[model samples]
Every structure is written in structure tokens, then in C-alpha cells.
Target: MALCVMMFLLVIPASLAQEDMDDKVFLFPKDKHTDHVSLTPNITKPLEKFSVCLYFFRDFLRNLNLFSLASPGTGNTFYFADSSSTNTVHMNQDSALFRTNMEPYEWKHACVTWNSDTGVVKLWVNGKLYPRRVCMKGSSIPAETSMVLGQKQDSFEKKSTTYPFVGEISDVHMWDYVLTPEEMLQALNKNAHGNIINWNSLLYEIKGDILVLPKSRCPYQITSKSYVDNGEDVDNGEDVDNGEDVDNGEDVDNGEDVDNGEDVDNGEDVDNGEDVDNGEDVDNGEDVDNGQGCL
Candidate 1:
């Protein structure tokens, strides 16, 4: 009877577990619609670290402008810029191309990993580590920025713009800590097949065209590219006219004047033996041979 009771207890809980799993809801965006999947409020811890992985395929004729996985807040943000003007990635914040140029019909499978304590951010574009430099130090994230996918939050406008994403997004995943490179690759493979592996007993799954995972910290690598530096106008040093710095306002010696026997002395007609007022001809009929004659 004791053995029978033990089996009954185990079976009851297993059945309940199956039921609970079945009850979990998976939501996905409608097909052929540009729907954004926003994270719930309070999904991230106040100051912990986190990371996110997204698999997307571009379909537009032009490459997209900016691809971002930014948390809703003032400080925490991560995005990839197509600054090269050639579909290559760049991290410069000041590149005009960054804001104006967009590559069409290019797909991306990218990941951003962030650590709040260290303030280090890393970006992986198609499993390759893209180069960048960080400027923003780790800081507490503001509570107002809403986590968004596929579009940029124009804070000044105070509304979500219709520059909606035009592509297929799947296998979105998030973790509370930085993922190792190997783990990231594995995740990518699993995502391609619409599968998620169990990590730390956390259940991960791709539900149709949407992904739902437990929120941890904001998963963004603080870019090594310093926005502060970007704001500073680069002074290539003024194009000071070549001879403007000479002490006596001397004409620049290009060697041609010396070889061609041209007058180098402020155009003063020495041959006439008098300062030709305002460069007018002072034909001193004698033709005094001053050796320095006008060509």
C-alpha cells in the first residue's frame, strides 16, 4: 500500500506538470503584418545584466537602415548601423550615412550581449564579432524607454513611427547574463530550426512566429563607439591657405618662378629704377639694366 501511494503521488504531479505546460500561451504576430513584439514592463531587473538574440531575414529591395535591440530607457541601448554605405557594418555614431543610408533586401542574424556591472557591450553580426569601441559607461537604465524591436524610438517625436520593420523575425531569445560565444552559436542553430534548449532549468521555445522568454536584464552591449566623441566635430585642422602662416607674407616658392625667371619680389618693377605706382609701366627710357627684368 505504501508503494502504491508513492506511485500515485508521482503520477499526480507529473500529470499536473503536463497540464500546466499545456496551459502556457504562445503569442505570435500575424502573417504578412509588420507587428512589433514589445517586452512587458518590469521584465528586466533594476541593474542586472542580460543579452538577446534575434534571427531576421530582410525582404525589401533596399538594405535596412538601423537594426536595434534597445531596452526602454535613457541609457541602455544596442543597435547596428549600416554606415559603410555599402551594406557593410560600421559603429560610428557620427557617420551621416548611418542616418541617411539604408541597405535594401539584406538579412541579418545578430546578437547583443550586455553587462550592467561592467558596462561592456559586444555585437555579433552573423556569428562574426563586429569591431567597435565603447564610450558610455555602465549606469542605471531610465524606466521610461519601452523595449522595442525592428524600429527606432524617436524620443523627441514621442510616438512610434511607422518606419515599421519589413521582414521575418523569429527565434527571439533573452538571458539574464552574458552568453559565451559557443552558446551563442548553438542558440543560433536552434533558432533557425525554431527550437530553444533548456538552460539553467529555464524553458525556451519559439511559438510560431513569435518568441516568449523570461525577461532578465537589458541585453545590450554598450558600444565601444563613443557617442561623446561622435558629437565632437572632428577638426581636420582648418585648411589654412598654404602660405598664410609665413611671417612676412612671402609668396610660396614653387621653384617654377625661380626656373622661369619670374619676379618674386612683390611685383615691384626693379628695372625701371622706381617703384611703379600701382603696377603701371614706368618706362624709364634708359632701360637701366637691373638684371631683374620682367619676363
Candidate 2:
């Protein structure tokens, strides 16, 4: 009996527990109809107000399903999609379209919040909050639902083949209440996490062709920054200031060299008494008549 129990425990998947998914991403390589990620949240009660946020990097501008939450009757209980011209957030089958310019093949951060009491919905993209709109006025999302990424879930059915996401997605989170502006900023910076679906301790199962991989970030970091009286080389991938501050390739002190033919100390090279100010050679206060002008 003991051996059997141990074997059964070993066969159980890690998705059954909270996972630390920080600094990781879900990569949907292609538009496979069955490819999706099923997320499990800890909420067992209906939510009157909620917020969802994620970061996505895509190359194509076609129909893309960012997040989907489906209940018994409403497939789009809370769905978010993106296109070239606009981003739409749905609540209980009703959606609000937010028109904004989206850049292709770049990482974009999006956050959506909805309150059933007021039916007001707000969308923020890359830390900029857009105009608010209202949807699903008094309806709350049922707790018995299916949440997914990469494709939309229709009443627990994965049927978003045409609108499958094609790129990388990371830092997916959801809260039971609408986050304030300061809280949202903290979420964008990874300083805050969701209580309902925390990305740091997420519980998820990968299906089909989805890839769980580490996120792309710069490996090198600047440890410290300081201004030195003596010349020092800073190779931390940042600009360095030498003894004389150079602005736009021009010396600030004006006593240093300039490439635009501005001479030092009135064209005298190093104050050595060489008459190079006017580019004409004269012998020590003696003017040579070069036939163009005579003394």
C-alpha cells in the first residue's frame, strides 16, 4: 500500500500546486487549433469587479486572442482580443472596443478592469490609461469557469483556431477587484501580483504546442553610477562622461579641440608661435609677399 501511494503521488503533475512562474513566458509557436494553456485560479466565489493584465509580443497584426474566461452560458464572460486598430474587452458576452495604435513585433503591456456595480470598464496599454467605457452593467462572472491563454474558451470548449495568438506572453495576472492607478503601475513593474491568479504562484496546465520558456531580458546590469574626476571607462552599456562633458560631440569647455576648424587660442597650435591661424605661413612677424599682396 505504501509503494502504491508513493507511485501515485509521483505521477501527479506539478500543475496541481502553486508554481513560481516569474521571469518566464508562454510561447505559442503556431496557430494550432488545440494549442492552449488552461489556467486554474483559487477563486470559488462570483466576482463583481476584476482586473486582468498581461504582456504580449507578437509579429502579426491579425485577430489575436489575448485572454479568455468562460462560464456555463457565456463563452466570452471576460475576453480580451487585439487587432491593428483596436483592442476589445468583453464581459458577459458584451464587449467594449478601445481604439489605439499597436506596433507589430514589439512587446506590449495591457491591463483591463471591469466593475459590475457601475458597468464601467477601463483599459491601460503600456502604462497609459485610455478612456473608460461601460459593459455588462450588473452581471458578475460565475466562479465555475474555464480560463485560458493563446485561444478563447467557449463554454469550456477550446474553439479559437482562427484567432489563436502567435507570439510570446508573460506576466499574466488577475485580481478579484479593480486595481487603483498606483497598484496598476506596481503590477506593470512586477512589484505587485494578483490574488486570484498570481503569476508568481500560478497553477496552469499546458496543452498542445505551447512552450514554457524563460523570458528575454538583458543579462548585463549597471552596478553603480558615479562621476569621476579622473578618466574612467564605463562598459556597462551606458554612455560615460569624460573629464570634459561632451554634448552632441562638441566640447563643453570650448578650450578643448573641435573638429569644425575652430583653432585653440586663436589658431596657434599649442601656443608654439606657429602662425597657423589663417593657414598662411609667415616668418616670425615678417610678412612674405606671395605676389598676391606685397609689403
Candidate 3:
């Protein structure tokens, strides 16, 4: 029975561990040496060109590694990272620096693509493309590899905690070839699927302090809901209140019955006069002057 059970366990495919992680995020709560995520791509052949896309958010003002792919020979086979002030991308132990201003506590979308024929590297941040660079011309990234997030792997047997990632990361995808601009936009809009590694159907394992949670915001869903809510608010609050109740019930009717001298003896006219004076002097004239001048 023990032999049968062992055989059953051994026969279990590694793909069985994969889970659909659509609309989910990997939250790295803090920078810990042991905290990391292992990604399984099951790549059978080496890749001469590839693209990687992910969205990340950080409140910590420090450098962090976003993606790391390590092979038997090269540890920094493909590494993506960013600092508090700038961004850096590594391919085959060669790296390029990008002087892009990073806003604190803000979520950012980054996509990187590399072609070995020309050794050209391209980076897109939040749908904006950065200047192109080249590295490791004609080199191919090996397959049967180990990939991780939240930490950088230096070698097949060793990993580095230097520039460990903190905060949240989501929507990770990897393609076997460089994505076209349209495909990149589709990926950014969450409309494209990756052939190599799909976020919607991901094979990943958390090694340490990583939490898989629902993403905080869905852009299209949130925007659509907001438009619906805004429509309802405007229809109910503005049209009904301003057109019918406020205009007819309060403004027109009450203007004639109370404010158009009907309630003059009740101090309505005197209060109106005072309000008008205050409005013109303080609210309209001085307020605008002070606001424009001070600003």
C-alpha cells in the first residue's frame, strides 16, 4: 500500500499544481530574504525573443526586483527591477538603466521585450514606450528554467535578496516572442492572453510571505460602474432636484410667495440684501482675487 501510494504521488503531473489566478494579485507585505514566488513555464525549447508584462504597486521608497529568470549557466538570464527614482532591466548579466520618474504609492504597468537577433530591448511603462537599448546580441535564453518574483536569482543553486520586492504585483504574462504594439496595448488593456505564461491560468508557488489576493481595482469594470453611478446620480440628483423640485417647488413658487416681497415684513428682503452684499464683496470679488493671487 505504501508503494502504491508513493507511485500515485510520483505520477501526479506538475501541471496539476497550476491554478487560474485571474484578477488576483501577489502581495509581498515586506522585504524578506526568503519571501519569493516560483513560476513554472514548462518551456521545452530555448527562447530567442520574449516579452514580459506585469503590473506592480509599491508604497516603500526603495529598489525592488520585479522578475527574475535563472538558468543553469546564467542567473540574470532576464531580470527586471526598478528603484525609487529609476528603472533597470537585465538580460543575460547585461543591464540597461532607464531614468524614469516613479511616483510613490502608485500602481504602474511595465512591459519588456527582447530580441536576440539584434539584442534590442524595449520597455513600456503605463502604455508609454521608453528609449530602446541592446544587450547580449545573438544570445538565447535557456529553457527548463526557474523564474521568480519578489527576489532575484543569481544562479541555478543560489538566489539573491538584494533588491527584494515589497508591495503588490499582478497581471503577469510572458510571451515567446516580442509583442506588436497592438498586442502590447491589448495586454495593457487586459484583453490579450499569453502563450507561454498566462496570468489567468498560472502555475506558481509561494515560498514565503506572499499573499494571493484579488486585485484592488479593475479598470474597465470600475470605469463602467462609475459611469453608471454617475448617470444615476445626475439623473436623480440634478434633473429631478434642479428641474422639478428646486425650480418649481422652491425657486419659482417660493420666490413669488416668500422672497418677491411677499415676506418683506418677515425680514426676507433685508436678509437678501445682506446676502447679496456679502456674496458680491467676499465670495465673488475678494475670494477670487485671493484664490488666483495666492495660488
Candidate 4:
């Protein structure tokens, strides 16, 4: 009888265990027809530290824009606040875009962790560290103005509702405390390991990737492309048996049968559990089989 035992254990690192309790996740509307989603105070608190992570995809270059309010009454504007010029993060006012260009389909992951005491903000993309610039004394983000994705929140001179984000967004998670680069990377990686120092807990998890307002909140579409198979470049040796192939010697008995020219039961003739051939069987000994015939 054979007995089998199996056990399963899940080892969660201290870092990932901390963010598991964090609350404060939200998904913006996917209105590709519009330019922005209101980043209202009701949706987000003011003056308090928080973090936001979301996956974003844009089909048209014009539909890719990030809008925020720097101060009260200053009005919402693009992160760069310019349409006539081009920036590393911004695209032309009229350009066709698609999420396919952005590897990993959707914004595989994006996160913003901030600290008020030090006034430091960290952004992460695809589990990798991103550049950051401190907000000067008066340039800090205001609490009143709404935040918008895909397009500028505040109406600008050339603002048009024609171009909007046309991709999917998902796996959005946020925290109130500033997460370390290591912690942020773990969260963005979606791996269940890593340390989150001062996180308050998750706020929400907006399921799905489309928003149409009242009927749905955000305006966007969910379309997936076929996964491309990247061929392996490294060479693994070809399949073949490389072990030594040897032949048995005739005089050595080599487990051959002498009675009828058939292989012997133990490399030598044996009868009734005892060697029946001549004493030659004992003299030509190599290795004998116990109860079983030698091969």
C-alpha cells in the first residue's frame, strides 16, 4: 500500500500583506467621446496624502492627456498646459493613438504615492520607477478642482470634446500614505509580496473597464488583441540518446541461457533455486540475481 500526502502553503511577504488592507481605489469614466473626467473633491480628499494607480490605453494621440488642478480658481489644465507644443508625456492635439503601442496592453500599471511631510511624490509605470519633481510651495495640487484623465478638466481655448480616451483601464488601486519605491513596484507588479510602510488601506476597486455615465460612470471601451508568441532564441541541445551502447560478451555468460540457447535466469543456468550447470557457473561469477533473473 502507498500513502500520499500533499500540502499547500501561501507565503505572503510583509510588504504585500500591508497593502492588502488599503482602501481608496477608483476608476474614472471611459467616455472616449469626451475629453476629461471630473476629479471632484467628493471623489478625492484635499490636502491629504494619497496614491492612485490605474491602467490606461489611448487609441488617438489627442485622446491621451492628464489634467489636474494646481490651485483654487486657477482652473483645470493639462499637465503640460499646452496644445501647440509637444512634450515627452503629451501628444499632438490631433493624432491617432492606440494602446497596443504601450506594451502589456493596458497601462499594465500606474501608481502615484505622495508624502506631505517631505512634499515628495513618486510615480511608477509598469512596476518600474518614474521621474518625479517636487511641487514648489505654492504649486501644490489644490483640493477643490476636479482631476481628469484622457483630457484636460478645465475648458481651454482650443478644447474640443471630439477626442477622448478610447482604451481600457483596470486594476486601479490607491492608498492614503506614501508607498516606498519598492512597495509601489510590488503593487504595480501585482505580486503578493513587498512592504507598504504607512498605507491606510484600499478605498475601492472599480470593476470592469467601461463608463457611459448614469448608465455607466466612465466612458471607454474594452478591446483586447491576440497575444503574440515570442519565439525562444536560446539553443537547447537536440534530442538524442547519448548514453553508451554496449554489447554482451559471449563467454562472460552476460545473463544468457545455456540450456536452450536462451538467456539464463541469472546469467547462468539455475534449477530449483540452485545452480544446476557445472561448477563453471560458480567460477564464472560476476554479479548474481537474488530471486530475480539478471538482465
TM-score of each: 0.41, 0.71, 0.71, 0.41
> Model 3 over residues 109-132: C-alpha lDDT tens digits?
899999999999999987899999
Among these predictions, the greatest lDDT belongs to 2
Q: Write the per-residue lDDT of candidate 1 for residues 46-119, one digit (tens) a residue.
A: 43455666655444544432333344433114343333233322221311111223233333556666565665
Candidate 1 matches the true fold with a TM-score of: 0.41
The digit string of per-residue lDDT tens for model 4 on 90-176 reads 211222112223332223455655555664555565666555534322223444443454544333322345444455433444455
> Candidate 1: misplaced stretches above 4 Å?
1-35, 41-44, 61-107, 142-145, 156-159, 191-295
Spell out the clash pairs found in candidate 3. none
Measured on C-alpha atoms, candidate 3 has an lDDT of: 0.74
Model 2 residue 219 lDDT?
23
Better of 1 and 4 by lDDT: 1
Output the better candidate (2/4) by TM-score: 2
- Stronger candidate by TM-score (1 vs 3): 3
**Which regions of candidate 2 deviate over 4 angstroms?**
1-18, 219-295
